[model samples]
Target: MKWVKIKKAEINEWNEKLKATHASFFQYPYYASGYTFFLFSKPLYIKLVNDQQQELGYSCILNVGAFPFKAGLIIRGPVFFKTNVDHRSSLIALKKFAVKERYTFLRVNANEPAIEELLNTDSEFEHKDYFPSYKGSQGIDLNIYYKPFDELLKSFRTDCRNKIRFANEKNYLFEKVKTSTDLEKVYDLFVGLGSKKKFSYRPLKSYTKIFKEGIKHELCSVYTASLDGRIICAAFIVKDSQSFTYFSGALELQNIPAKYSPANNLHYLIMQDCFYKEDRKIYNLSYSPRESGVYMFKTSFRPEEICKPGFYTYVINRKIAERIFSLQGKSISAIRTKLRSIIKLFNK
Candidate 1:
């Protein structure tokens, strides 16, 4: 198999190819653009083909870090056109490409179980421990869209159903955000939530660019829930041809009553909106640890657990890669500590 590098001029064709396959949002060009803007990672689009020059799959990799210690990341991809395609050859080609480009290592978090099995069986690839990728996510089958609204509602757990109804009864206005000004309001809610939850999030400018580009390409939707003209909850959903992935969400828990269910209601509306869209068959709730409260909340929706092989790393130069990984981890930890301190100060 051979890998063909795709240039920026061919992105339209790349997008067309993606539409014909079951590629995820992470493989989309706009999604990569966001990382490029904020993280300064260079996007590398490559198409895999057999010796016969027939297309088998495509990968959107992000090349990160500096010279002599660069890493190539395949985030949730190398989306194949068919289920039976030879993933091993593709993996070999990726490794060769990374080596040829002088990368220290290559990390892949493919969405395919088969590929994961291949990586496990292969001696060259090792299970990544530090900064491991998500192994699974909760997803609702959008075929439920054909059922009656009441029947769909009945599918959820009782408490979830009650929360949805209660949220509706509270008359919180749920709407798709259209203007930039409203998006900023949603960002504020997201930042506020991150502060309260003590979690890290992308900066406002990064989110603004991402959302704007995504909206312009019809690949993203931002939803907001408000009571008395005050926003309380917001969510960002990214769409591919086959699924709507819940990317980010924030809730103003302090502003709303504990009994209020704005978050649940917002998700319900999102599901409905995704169902109405053609060819979108799945509503992905994104990743959460099985033991976490967030996992329980998502489970209340009765979504099936979709599992995948987690991250694997192929190191071209183990010594250099290990040192780079150490430094990267420390940098990330320091950043998180700084963010937590800032959030604490802001809360005070």
Candidate 2:
């Protein structure tokens, strides 16, 4: 088995035109934002082949540079196109590729249980397992996700059902954002929600670009809920051919009209919209941590908590560099969290 670095355009074709069943939206070229989201990203499209060079399997990787070190993020990938490809050998080849490419470590969110197990027990690699960012994602299987709109309403918790009904009674509007003007209204609400949560929000331009590009690719949709013409809730959803994921959502929980749940109503509308589109397997409600308010709220929707593969990092030759990278990563995260809290306090 051999690992070869292909052109970025080839990666795009492999993901977009070739359409690997196991690849997720994150592996797509547009999703990377071409270094606008991160400082630098190197696209790796490796094909596993024999002496005759017939295609066996392929892995899509984004090697992102974090100043002193590089990390390869494999999101639900290394899909084997042919059945004969050995999972363990392909993974071993990937590790060698990472080290050869001078990456400090490789972080993979593999799609298969066998790949996860290999990362955990393989002697050729050293790694640790963390809760997957995509794990515990609350989602509904569209096959039986809902009934008629009325039955769907009945499925929700009493309080939630009431909130949606109350919002409608009050003439609240649910809209699918289609223009820049509409997006601006939703983005403002999103930014406000970010401030309240105290997490750093991306620049407005970044979001604008993402929305425009995503729309062009038919991969993104924005939904909003409004009360008396004032926007109160907004959500961003992304999807591939099979899965619709709630990528981001924001709303004013406190200032919204009493007994009217704009957020819940918006979610209902979004799900309905996705369902109408036809080819959907999972309606991913996004990641939620244990014991958090968001987790509890998502649970009320009755979506299953699906546990998937998580992050696995295999360090390369530079132990000293790995230590430095690890320290810097933790320190930066700590400082950012503290800073966000400080900013929130001052704003209040």
Candidate 3:
């Protein structure tokens, strides 16, 4: 019945070391959760916990600050999984914090999608059914999900499967990145791809720090696909106990190169190496751009469109903040769509 801000040092031991040392979403050391990616706007993160005794079913949240109009607050995730009644207690505690903090609405977009099983029966989330959804999830989920590699491959489009086989025949080297220096290559490839495709340069140092500190905390990781000792494709993965998301990626030399399109094959590699029959269960490909060939590429993999969750915003008045946030959300989505249109014009 009590909520307290866990000190940073203490928070590390719980989410970083303890969760990491024992169980994690991805087996690779890099996918840990608590590190700061962007240093400029530090997020106030929370771990919904039941540490009063033995705990179960709590979410870890990242408080991403208020939305413009000062009527909304955004949190990257409220990643909650229930293991016991404690989850309900934790959520109730968090609900109080949200209201007392005077945040008109809590905008939550899970880093990954909510599980169907949980939605069918999770009683922990008070506002689980309260918010209107913004979009459907367009990604592959691998948590508690496994099938024979042949079945998995058969599931992909012929072109995708063929690309993997072709890339393999070409003798491309796949290497896992382990150091800060390795990120320079990743950044370069990302920048090249972004420039060629007209997308903004992804914040590399923030990502690098995630990988570096993740290794320390066991949260962030990278994989590079190389040709003749030079990196051609690179991807960074994010993990928690329930999911592994390919967060950022790039390919240097392109024309939809077989070397990079074989990303599904790379995904297969991650399961074999990082997940390796662990409690970990989901692999998320992230949101499909939905307006371009990239979306076709994602859909060719056959990930089902699942209903995704959004953050809950409680308006002091039912209508005021809701309309404002709704408009803001639409405007933001429109801008992103426009940006993607511009980017796709140059995609190789």
Candidate 4:
């Protein structure tokens, strides 16, 4: 079998064929990469075919130019099938691509079955590790597979439900905002919540853009929390297939009474109706809350287990790409070690 580089003539054909092969976020049509981005980038598609030109395996790659160091990130990616194609060789090719472009480093998040499988095999990395990750497949699925409102809360810890009830007892009201003007109150409360939680501050522009897009594509929605007429909390969710992703949420802390927690109350209202009932999508609790306080709070809303793979596939660079990739490996290893020390110091 021989593998040939894919050109523009086969763009649509490649995507359509890959769709039938795997359930990968990197392959999904809506993501930044899947969309018209390929137009500007002109992705690289490799197909392992028989003499009859019958396709046996395929993958997609992008000769991407990254910022900061202005490195060329020729990613070997979007591998759908691997029966005949060699994983190590492909990775080596990826590295070669990096070196040819004179890139300082090569970054790849190959969507494979498991990272463990790549270890102990050929092409083992010396300076490779993980960074704080962004949830992908699971995030979208939460928006795709929705549960009915009533039954959705069955898994929530009793305390979480009680908190919602408590929020109601405190006379909090939920409203669906249809216009940007209506978002002001929700935005204020959300910002307040963010400050209280000591979380990162994202500009209003970001949330507004997401909310508008969600409405446009029917991909997700936003909800505002109120006590009578005064807004107290706000959240936005993105719909992905059958999953209702909990994009982000914020709640006022000090202004509200001690009887109820804003996050719990805000989440339940969305789960029971906005997402679960209205959207008919599954509720994603989002990143398994790691902060002790946040984890305690999220546990109240029991969730199902979802183990999703990270990265789509690995490609190695030849000659020059290999050296650049090696530098990247060393950098990642150093950063991970430093991060671990920081976490340790925080714990101490």
Candidate 5:
């Protein structure tokens, strides 16, 4: 098979036909603008074809990284139009391209079934363990087998259902975010949430583009839960034609009343919007660690657990890549360990 790097128009043309939820927003041409503040991003499309020039599959690559740390991120890509493409061959071709381009590593979060199968089989690629991981996401099918809204509530755990009722009793109202002022409220809450949860937060400008560019283009939407004119929680939803991903959500845990569960209520409202308004087939809760608090909360809504081979890294230069990646892992682990000790000390 031959690999040909196609243009943005071609990528859009192909994506127009595919409209798969398994893909990443990062791979979308429009989504690139939101990410430019973090890394230099270029939308790339590599088409796989046979000797007869028959189209096999196409990969959407976001070529990104800082100076002296170049990497290619492939998110749910090498989307095949036909069923006959060789996953290994296409991957090897991608590796060759990365090496030729002098990238340090090529990281892939394979979403396609064939590619996931290949990654699971213990192929040549080396796995890179990164935080805020690129693992498979949990998603709820909005169509086909999904139960009706009332049935869905019944399926939730008793405590979860009760929490929703409590939120209702609190009389929280959900509204679509429309202005820059609303965006700042969400960002401030998100920052507060990040500090409380002890996780890294994206800069405000990163979110600004998502609001201005993504929402303006109708690729995303923001909804806020409020009580007495105070925003208690907010959720950002991103969509392709087939799915609505709950990309991010922020909660003001301190401000909400004892009986109210802002997260649950906000998500319930968001899911309703996904089902009724968006008419999307999948309501993606996005990725979270299994059995974690976030995971339990998401699963309480009864979304299906989507399992697949997550992120894998193919190091172009073994010696340099190993040292760099290993150091990164160790550094993060050290910081986490120190933070935990500090927290324990404070408790004492």
Candidate 6:
């Protein structure tokens, strides 16, 4: 087997090949471009081929962090076209590449259980205990698309169904975002929500590039809910051929009543559209802690829990990797413990 570096000009062809696998939007060249532009990470698209030169799989790796401490991250991928392919050989090749490039470690956070099982058995790959927040996601099966819309509505919890009905009764205008002005409005709401919730978000310029490129590729859709000429809620949904993922969203919380439910309504509309119109098979509600209010809201739609093996790291330079991991763990712990205070300082 050999690994070939795919060039920028050949990204579209690579993406087409990716569609043959169980790859998500994260492995797309556009997503890599967005991350590269925002985080200044170098994106490497590497394809694995057999001796006969037939493509077997590919991974979109991001070379991140400063030199001498840099790490390669394969987020949500290293997508293989077939289930029976030798996954171990691919990891071995990737590890060799990382060592040759002088990377401290290589991190993989693939959604595939097969890869996760392989990593668990491999002594070289250590499971990273940090970032435990994304162990699973909530997924709504869109197979009910064949049934009546009312049947799909009935699948949700009573309270959720009531919220959707309430939103409709209030004549909330829910529509697909069409213009840059609409996107700006959505970004403003996203920023406002982040501030209110004491969290951080990517800058608008990054979002602009992601949304623009994703829309051009038919891989993204932004939906908004408006009332009396003011946008109340918005969501960004990224999709592959089979599934639509609710990537990010925001709600205007200024004077909205609990019963108003624009956020819930927005998601309902999105799911409805994805099911009946887009012909998707799954609606991924994204990730949140099981104990969080966000999780409660997402569960009201009665989505099934979809779990995966979390992040794993393969050390290349043992001494450097251990030191970096120790510091990184402490830093992450400190941030989580003092997040509120940090947000306050930033606000001041």
Could you estimate the TM-score for every candidate?
0.85, 0.80, 0.69, 0.59, 0.78, 0.86
- Those runs of model 5 whose alpha carbons end farther than 4 Å from true positions after fitting are 6-26, 39-45, 49-56, 64-68, 120-123, 127-145, 253-255, 287-292, 330-348
Q: What is the C-alpha lDDT of each candidate?
A: 0.73, 0.64, 0.53, 0.51, 0.66, 0.73
Clash number for each model: 0, 0, 15, 40, 0, 0
Clashing residue pairs in candidate 6 (N, C-alpha, C atoms within 3 angstroms) = none
Candidate 4, poorest ten consecutive residues by summed lDDT: 67-76
* Residue lDDT tens for model 2, 1-348: 767766656654554542446556665555545335432344566777756877777666765544234556676766676776777888877877787877766667666777778877777555552212222123222222635656766777777777777877767777788987788887788778778888755556656766776777677788887776888778888766666778777777566555877777778777776666545656778766767877666766667656666567676646634453444445444533543454466567
lDDT-sorted candidate list, best first? 1, 6, 5, 2, 3, 4
Predicted structure with the largest TM-score when compared to the true one:
6
What lDDT tens digits, residue by residue, belong to model 5 across residues 112-176? 66677776565667665332222223322222224577776777767778788888887677888
**All models, RMSD in angstroms:** 6.3, 6.6, 8.2, 9.1, 7.5, 5.8
The digit string of per-residue lDDT tens for model 3 on 1-348 reads: 444555666544555433532233322223323223421123343445455743332233333223322232233344343434443444456667666655544543444343323322444333432233222122233232455655667777787777667767666778789778888888888888888888865366667656765666555678888877788778788666555667778766555454445565666677555445544556666665579766666666666555454443434434635544454445444634543454456463
lDDT for residue 130 in candidate 2, whole number 0-100: 26
User: Which candidate model has the greater TM-score, 4 or 6?
Assistant: 6
The model with the greater TM-score, 3 or 4, is: 3
Q: List the residue pairs that clash in candidate 2.
A: none
Q: Rank candidates, TM-score, best first.
A: 6, 1, 2, 5, 3, 4
CA displacement after TM-score superposition, residue 229 of candidate 4 (Å): 2.8
lDDT per residue for candidate 6 within 137-237, as digits (tens), equals 23222222233676877888999888887777777888998877789988988888898899967667766777777777777899988988888888888
Q: What is candidate 6's TM-score against the reference? A: 0.86
Clashes of 1: 0
